[model samples]
Target: MNNIILSIIFFLMLSTIVFLIKSKKNISKLFLSILIFVGVLIGAGLLYLILMIFDNDTNISDTIKTMIPLIASMVAAASVVIATYNTVNGEKSSKNKTILEFIDITRDILEKGEITEKTTEILEQINSKLKSTDFKVDVLVNNGAREFFEFLNAVEGKEKIYILDRLEKCFYYEPGSPLDDLKKELIRKLKSNNIKDMRKLWVNINQLAGTPAKNYNILYEECSYSLTNQFIEKDLVNSKFYTDSLLKNDRKIVDGLLRKHFELKYEDIPIQYYEVYRVCNNILESNYEQIGHFFRTVHRTLKTINSYYERNSLEYREHIGMLRAQIPNQVALLMFYNAVYSEKGRGMARELLASNFFGDRDDFHFENNELLRSEHFLNNGRFLNNQDAHIAYELFTYNKESNKVYNELEKMEKKVVPVDDSETKLKEEIFTHYLFNKEKILLDKFIKEFHTVPRKFDEYKIFMNPKNNKK
Candidate 1:
């Protein structure tokens, strides 16, 4: 009886340790069944030993108790052992089935010889269903590739690409097969890219990426430029963000790409028409200096390409978020002032009128021009009330158009203010007094230049001439 009890205790301890070690592999509910079986076997063995030791008179019941305990323990251990095998095998079979399904789906894509929205969707669904399986598979395809051979070259073609695609398709039917191992082998084949393969690689990359206006070429160039920084080193003309498209009206896309390139590359991308081009909408309310810095850092490349330039002129005049664009109204204003300055340089006393204009004149309205009209009105109200010619001319050419603009300038301008009683102070006060009447001088010049005042200024002739016609 003592020997039987000792053997049962030893067997239970050994089985528990074995069960625990195997449990480490999966550690599922089979562990609880193993523990219960061992507990029942140990209890039965102890009970039989108690019956034997207490029944020393050798009764018929003592023999039955011992035999029943031995049979129960053997039965329990055998049942639990079989259940453990099923649990482990079930988990393995589920994993194997998942891996097989993934291999089959991947094979279908290769056999179809094309990728589509439907195909991508199918692949994603397979990824979802097979996530529980421990096998990791990542599919990498060159979106830009025209042929399988090109993709092969880009991935260095260490393993045969064409054959692998065919093999992947076949593995799906044999789910419990070596397909997982073969997929890993293909991944190994796709690791490195050579410098000579850059053009092909870039083309493949651009093909897969989507853009609203199909600016894939620009993206390809950007990727190339990022790899080499050749755009800066060679001083190449920065590529326009707009690619070849059907309608060809993508100015907004062009603007967005320009800003994105600048932000990403930190390279100077020439944004033409700086006065009108805005990098950020939020920057519109920013300080003039910050706006100026943004403009200066970006290269300005303006070209007169054709009638296309006509529609684009509107972008310059409006405030777009943080940035500002120059428009036709402002462009015409600058041109008029430049023409006036050029005339001044040429030493001409004759004030040029719209009728005398000879350069690029295409339906320019004197009143329609916003800058000219605003300046004319302001000066007429201020300095021209007193007919000061010099002041009117200076105001028209140099002064900013609005008081808000003037106040902004004053806040920016730094100068030593004059103290009272100094000689310089008196001169400043006198200049300040003259400056107040400066607008009158601008109105007088406008009257002389545009309103048909006499071109010849002779003191004796003017008195002889009609009073209204005096220069």
Candidate 2:
């Protein structure tokens, strides 16, 4: 009976130690103290047993000898249980303290209505702590998100941009954060059709990115001068005279002469054309850094969300759809132009196209001259005077017909074309020939049977056939 009781005690002690070691918890000072006391008792019990075994003169009986070790083992087991209880309760208290501290800090920042240097520091500290442990403060994080939105609603302009930058940091650091929802809200709030509002939006973006503000009049004058010169050089009549003529005079006099010449030669050019050109130049030349940063941030956020969900899942589609819906038609048009014209925005444009960010809406046009079809191509077949059309075309097409068209264009390029003809006209002729070539009559037949064709083919037919270019 005594040996059985001792065995049970020993088993309990061994189990407690094994469990504690496997749990990988830090051994607290109280636990260490108790363990030390239990060790001393065990040492004394062993000494007594040794004395009884070796010395015949020992007064301890067999039962007493057994009881000593048994008592020691029981005491050791009890100490372990008590130590574990204290350690667990202490951890609970510490965790509760940490949570409360985070709550307090968040509340203070919210009450201040602005994020200061100190606030950023505190947030960083908290982030570091949370990252180092398995602890999660989801409730606090969600509540903070709501409070942040409320605060964001109360701010505008630079302050709004500042807060958004901070908010992005918060979401970026927190794993599985509700960043997509935050981005959606930002898109809805920032999107605008009004030019003035859009300008203000870009200005704020520029400010955030530390880019200097652009002078609209100066940029407009430069664009007008450049466009007028191009027009003069491209003139079918008197092109040689204009190309040969040179002006050397005072700076202001030269500008005045160019202005007067532009007025006389392009009197029929609408103001909207100049306005579009000015806007494009402003975006591509003066403010691309800031605008690019804004779009890249948005793209990364969306990409992060995409990584979390299955591609074909309803959740992924719905989230992407919600973001796409927030972008108004005019805003999307601007984004399309920016993506198409700016070299830095090419990857973003491709991602936007693949994700169908432009949507399937057809009631939009670029500068009232080109019709956008199927959320991708320009319908009028004009190359827009640069590689813009080619870049856009390449991005939108990924099939055999497009490949065939490319090959045909390469072959056509080897043939002599008139020097007086603009590159836009030449490319347009190439596209027309590719569509109507006798050997590729199947493409034309496919276009005739549009209803039987795939949606992309239908889009392609609409793009290639000039008859479909209408409001």
Candidate 3:
């Protein structure tokens, strides 16, 4: 009976030790130490039982045998308790040390207002340490939020962009639950009114379309010069009268004079095409760098949100909605034009599409049945209707068919007979037509026959099936 009991106890102890070893990664040193101490006592008891059952010495008294195991257990237990206490204290100290180091590095980086390769390495270390079960993320988040905002406030221009870019890369590669929580907290901080500059950073980027020109006066001067030159060339201008009218800066007077003297209606007035282009070109030249930075900032922000939440989840929708609201109708319209026309803006367009930035039609609308006034410059006389915009949105966002079409168009451009216009212009025209018509069958037929056929917009009708072809 004694042997059987000892054997059962031994079996349980062995099983427990195996469990503790298996769980060593998860459990703290303190608990593991306690288990080890208990294991040693169990091991001593097993040895005593073995002696009684197998040795059959009959030399030692029962009291001495019992006392031997008891004393050994007590001594071993005390040693283990002291060791475990020291281990627990040391672990606590180490964790504290790691956290302090992380804080110090973060503060140094923030103060320096630069993120280099070293910064990334330090961030990785911080991430690794924070991933430990012993670390409390809430404490770090609470303390770190203010520091992060301070960092944002300190950096500007290219430096800020660099930081955001590196931070995004970090988030992508060094993801953990704690880091996710930190990202959420950082997002919340960004949205909060506590950091006015941070809020302005996002707001200003979204509001880029509000002011496309560096100087409104410069645009006015260019327009005035173009209009005056046209009037003089038409033999309709009284030079002094035109000069006085322009000085007054009254559009009605200018329009009335042009109508009465030059017989030019508002719509008939020659678009200052070259002047407008110059002004726009200047705007792009001056602010293009800033615009790229702004796009990157918005992309990184949305990407971070996207990483943590499912696309269809309520949290995702709410956050995305809040971001979308910051971009006004004109701005969204500008983004559409950028996406369509500019090479550098394509990635921004993709990010915007992923975030459903154009999910609402009303958000892209402006007064006077126009998408936006800037449309005149960007549309190449092929304006975007709501349906066209919606079709483009669907093709880009839902089906990813637009990208395929773009690729096919590129291939067709290379193979087909050269047109008078640039390849870009031809592609833009056909792509715009695709958006306008939303004719999938025609597109498919065009793709199939493009290699042999001349690339002309007028020839697109031939791709239509006879049954559905319009005269």
- Number of colliding residue pairs in each model: 24, 0, 0
Best by TM-score: 3
User: Which whole-number lDDT from 0 to 100 does residue 455 have in model 1?
Assistant: 21
Estimate the lDDT of model 2: 0.40
The digit string of per-residue lDDT tens for model 3 on 266-373 reads 222222222222332343444455344444555555555555555546656666666655554443454544443344544444444434556633334334433352
- Full-model lDDT for every candidate: 0.33, 0.40, 0.40
> What is the Å distance of residue 122 in model 1 from its true position?
18
- TM-score of structure candidate 1: 0.20
**Candidate 1: tens digits of C-alpha lDDT, residues 327-403:** 22222222232223221211111121211111112222233222132322223322111222232233222223322
- TM-score, every prediction: 0.20, 0.24, 0.25
Worst 10 residues of 1 by lDDT: 132-141
